[model samples]
Target chain A: MNAMTDRIAGVLVLPQPYVLFLGDTTVPGFAKTAFGLRDWAADKCVGELRLPGATVTTGLEALTAAEAHARGARALVIGVANLGGVIPANWRASLVEALEAGLDLIAGMHMRLADIPELAEAAHRLGRQLIDVRVPPPQIPVGTGRKRSGKRLLTVGTDCALGKKYTALALARAFERRGIDSDFRASGQTGIMIAGGGIAMDAVVSDFEAGAAELLSPDAAPGHWDIIEGQGALTHPAYAAVSLGLLHGSQPDVFVVCHEPGRTEMLGTAGYKLTSVEEIVELTLLLGRRTNPAIRCGGFAFNTSALGEAAATELMARESARLGLPVADPVRGGPAFDVLVDSCLA
Target chain B: MNAMTDRIAGVLVLPQPYVLFLGDTTVPGFAKTAFGLRDWAADKCVGELRLPGATVTTGLEALTAAEAHARGARALVIGVANLGGVIPANWRASLVEALEAGLDLIAGMHMRLADIPELAEAAHRLGRQLIDVRVPPPQIPVGTGRKRSGKRLLTVGTDCALGKKYTALALARAFERRGIDSDFRASGQTGIMIAGGGIAMDAVVSDFEAGAAELLSPDAAPGHWDIIEGQGALTHPAYAAVSLGLLHGSQPDVFVVCHEPGRTEMLGTAGYKLTSVEEIVELTLLLGRRTNPAIRCGGFAFNTSALGEAAATELMARESARLGLPVADPVRGGPAFDVLVDSCLA
Candidate 1:
């Protein structure tokens, strides 16, 4: 067990009843945090606060920061997952308004909210916390890679922010439905907020990346399952270190490769094509063998949100036949997902 | 080019002409920092300071911190590289005494020297700097992994604290001797002290690991070579993420596999066996191709300090023949090392 787990876990105690803040974002993809909170923790979300030009919504009731605070919202959660996790200059007014209205500011951006002058001054004067979940806890030990007793599964991807988190969440829910013991081990900001506890693997120092992952899912019961949420793709140019470290430290006995069809280029990278599912599976097994020799590919999960039901079903079946493994969109849970769960457990 | 390079290069201005402090370390391996500085930056070093039980020496003139300060040394460099980079409790008195004697303290340990209460108080009172080289610079951009123009040679090891840094230093010097435009890019503390300026790759945030490496060796003339000092090994359970990130980011055209023959277990890892040079070669090529498809293994370097001259020679020749590559000890610079350097440039 990680010695710092208890102390580190205590550091991220966010106030409940949040008003999801959507900045000047138009794309629905950028509002994943709001959508995720609404989907997984709807009861905790009082409403959503959107800027003047914002076009995307999490379908919750809209409210201003003052209105949300009046309605008992204790914090304003920045719900946009932008390209660089940067808070725009235009968002300062809304953030300051929240602090003035007796609410804390919560963010998962790369840049801390406390670093922004207006926000920092407002929060300090208001005596409200400026919580940045992406800040890793200190003194995370280096990974030992010693095998621990557990039945583990991980959701890996061909790129960033595709469907790895959703797949793991769905798998863990299915395991619970079957009366199987399991936990959804989150590794990112959204998933951490949803799970209410997880280490921000990317925020840790490079020397302790794997150690942070190992601490995320410690030893469990022999039959218990840790459906670990993955980070970057192993083929990703910028973030593969986090991916590889999580893989080796999690030591998953089985893995599900997540992909998004029709996506050509990697996120935030040019001239780099999306890696093939076959390549992902091969590489996962090859590299994962360093820590877990019995690692196996459970199946594939395709984010077919752009495709109709018939087209998505046809593509999944065709790929399943080619790979000789179960394949399904975990979001569209059905008999196929059931088969995937069985194969993963088998 | 990196915009922050110039600013970061100015952060580590160590007042040189220093005293190297060995803090109760007996094993020569644990005193790598002292030896590395003595071997690479002898002109900057004035004398050595040892605690009562310290049995190791860098073969420099022994002088107390006060004596060294009187003789024009400006700082006391913590020259021990123990297993965790920790400062022993018994050595705190010596460190405080150095500050009393008007010497700044420079350390590459995981913990900052300024974080120690006594040292911090003394340094504050004395107005002396406590420079911690392991602290990474802020806002390192994510690696793009676009192939930059310039040849690179990285030295990869089978375990930690072996010959990776030494081999890179030797290769860079050899390149300069051959009238080649080259630079030795430091990635660790001792190397940073020797080279005067370089990134501490292991200290950066996990998300920016590759980015740090990319910034460490930026674009240069087509004929210029960047001999990068490698970090942890790819097969290492605790630190493979750092190794893999450096490999992908540097995009080394040629890499030299370094090993310490006759070692049974990995450093600091009890059950983990040492990785073979063959395994490292295969893994480096397979993973390194993600960034540089033309990546090649140039040769092998063995730390033959534990063996007799005849035994070392016989083993080098046999291994060279078996692997179909040049093999030599860079420290024992001879005709074999010359051949190794020739093959690396080929």
Candidate 2:
């Protein structure tokens, strides 16, 4: 295709199943994912839609048929499954058909596979291109032993408007007042900083590529604690997807998901509840386990005025314990919320 | 016009301006009376160009012309002037022309006798329509023999995002803790709240209309103690215009204009520096004298983190005495700043 035609056709990697496992539920994560893709496509001026897939035994066949329908698809993103295995036999024909139709498959594998000869052979037979998303095992540096330095905690929140960023910053400030060298990672803030570079194709493409590379590489140097900030209402799924990409890339020691108050009760106009602190935390923990198990995980930190620090702490503690992780309070106490930050990192 | 066509052509009056004011030396006060007329035939989008003479002068000619131009305008907004009187001749003509062009002029001042006569005459002449922006002024009851009881203090910040809302909220909290009854009125926050309602209009239009109605009406009650936050980074002229309107409308007992830390320093993106805080203060004091001679005004509240409590207090006292108003500290104690809400209010 010519340059203009290629631009119009727009090569997109549609993740298989159209939705990945978010915690234990098979909810409509597409709207959220699609929103993120839309945000990425903003400057490109491209349109995108997620293919539908069933949850039952016919799910694989259904996904393949959907892929077949996307005949002119230039790229295919094979979403990583929790369990590692070969492609199902029933769906093999559809996969070959997709390749014959000139689809470049990008297989994202969360598992630490020693080899993928079978998959490679299948792709070769179909005359398709493949890019393996196989992340290596995380390891601490030689000198940096796994010695607990009194739980050097790193807290992260969403954005200032959403109250998560402030909550995290307040927690960090509280820790500082208490003589704790806690690192507060405002990933949302960093994302805003990066995005503020302006909505341009090259910028976004570089950001995505860099984000992907960062996700695959595990760096032992102390992670820079940053908050994530944005203008739009927190319901946009793009926020959640970006959060996922950042969390995966940064490999934060402990993730502290911050959320707005009363967000859990509201029917998010974005057709999903990525703003729900509990839901996001659950998904983060699940993704962490599947993508990088070495990264230790924490729990949610909700706004104090919304959830009340005590209730929020207890509820989060219960939830974290259920997930076999450390418990932390989202908000600090007066002077500021002091107990919450101290306990979370401790 | 058909329903869809009418909907497309319908003028939407946004009730607030989400403005980021940048710069220091440009204007001494807020801009309340600026008019914006977009040429849909050219770019089909509202360009950021303020109408000349509309803000500075006033008369029927300027008003008429503005109205005539607005007749074919997809949207028309009349920013209420705070200081200036009598619309300029050229501006009158422009306004009338807009009305004749079949534009829906949305304004808050349509109820005023001076404004109403022209509006009705223009509507009759143009055979067009008009929509008055109706936002009821805040009501605080007063009885016979009722006099101002408690001290009325107003907090004016340097600009937006300079921690104005934070300072205001902290001050309120501090006063509450000190058993002092304090009420807050922030034009900045109010503007944002009104805009968040999804009123389809531009920032300048909404803000100007809301500001004019809020500021000028005698029926409007100023909060017991108001914290009028200014827009930060005064790059846009609209911020100054809005600030001026707020200042003129909500005549306060004592005005505390917050100044940045340094007289000559670059902070924030716009690189704004208050070259002559004293000169600006003098100008404001002069304007205050013109409006209300008895009104007392406070000098600049320079944000300092290095000064000791005694030094800061002394500085405040000296500045307040110089400006003929009480000295109030936004951050109490020297450099180790603690938001001393109670002590400051007290």
Best by DockQ: 1
- Candidate 1 C-alpha error for residue B247, in Å: 0.3
Once superposed on the true structure, which residue ranges of model 1 sit more than 4 Å away at CA?
A1-6, A9-19, A23-30, A49-57, A61-76, A81-105, A116-129, B1-6, B9-19, B22-30, B49-57, B61-76, B81-104, B116-129
lDDT of 1 by residue, A85-185 (tens): 79989889989989999888878887899899899898888888887778776668788888988889999999998899999999998999999999988
Query: How good is the docking of model 1, by CAPRI class?
Result: medium
Give lDDT tens digits, candidate 1, residues B1-346.
2211244442234577779999888999888788889999898899999988889999999999889999988889898878776887899999999999988888998778988999999989988888787876776889888889899999999999889999999999899999999998999888987876678888888788888888888889999999999999998878988998899889999999999999867876537889899999999998899889999999999999999999999999999999999999998879999999999988
Q: What value of lDDT does candidate 2 attain over all alpha carbons?
A: 0.36
Taken over the whole model, the C-alpha lDDT of each candidate is: 0.87, 0.36
- TM-score of chain A, every prediction, order shown: 0.87, 0.38
Q: Give the TM-score of each candidate.
A: 0.87, 0.25
Candidate 2 local lDDT, A1-346, one digit each (tens)? 1211111212211223221111121343422322332332233211232233523121222234234435333544333233343443443454454556555444334322224555467668866555333221122111111121222233334332454444545555555666654443323212211121111111122113213223222233343233222122212222222333334334344555555545543222223333444444554454333223444434445554657556866665665567554344433444223434544555
Candidate 1 local Cα displacement, residue A224, angstroms: 1.3
Give the DockQ-based CAPRI class for model 2: incorrect
